[model samples]
Target: MSQFVLHDELWWVSEFSCESCGTRLCEHAGPGAAPDDVRQALLAAHGSVTLRPTGPAPGLVPVLRALREASGVSLPQARELAAELVRDGLAGTPAEMGLLRDALHRRGVPADVQS
Candidate 1:
């Protein structure tokens, strides 16, 4: 139910992802370098179609900054870490959070137990 906009030589409305990252700018081309091709490729690979404009969203910038600060990492480093977690399948699905919690417990990191 979320919405996103793909804008290049033209614009289209679709679902949202981290589109503002320029990862899907040329995703819709059947076989060319147009931003549309990039958009389609992104959807096929990452499962989203909404293209974000080429800049950080005003509000999200500060929030991301805070997360990075708290984690003691730069924004790019934090993003890379998250991406690695996803790629390595170390992250859990929403439904799998409970299972992940149990696994974490077995590893001695009890949930809600605080540091």
Candidate 2:
């Protein structure tokens, strides 16, 4: 049987591995979304999580900085992700989104996660 493991680590990093074969499929670090295939696999094995900012709007600069610190993305990339968080929100594995939600909250950005 083939089995996969997913790890959501620091810096918004995620690692994927095969348990049966000891194969490492991916080790991604940064704020970018995981590949569709990886997402699908995770969804199949685990579940999905959605994260959205709640309460009053937070300062853009703080949001941007939080995104940068949490995701290890550059300023411009963090800007784009902060925009997305403010606009449509973000989706990922439970652990992934949970880490982000905590990071944002620590930076004084109110956010919630649903899984």
lDDT of every model, 2 decimals: 0.34, 0.71
Best by lDDT: 2
Estimate the overall C-alpha local distance difference test score of candidate 1. Answer: 0.34
Over 1-115, each residue of candidate 2 has an lDDT whose tens digit, in order, gives: 1122234333334566789999975466554455667667767778777889887655888888777766688998988887788788887677667777877887888999876
Candidate 2's TM-score reads 0.65
Per-residue lDDT, model 2, residue 113, is 88
> lDDT by residue for model 1 over 1-115, one digit each (tens)?
1112222112223333465684433223232122445455444554522111222223434434433443346888756643443344233222122333333333343332111
Off by over 4 Å in 2: 1-39
Clashes found in each candidate (C-alpha, N, C closer than 3 A) = 16, 0
After TM-score superposition, the amount by which residue 47's alpha carbon in candidate 1 deviates from its true location, in angstroms, is 34
Off by over 4 Å in 1: 1-67, 89-115
TM-score of each: 0.20, 0.65
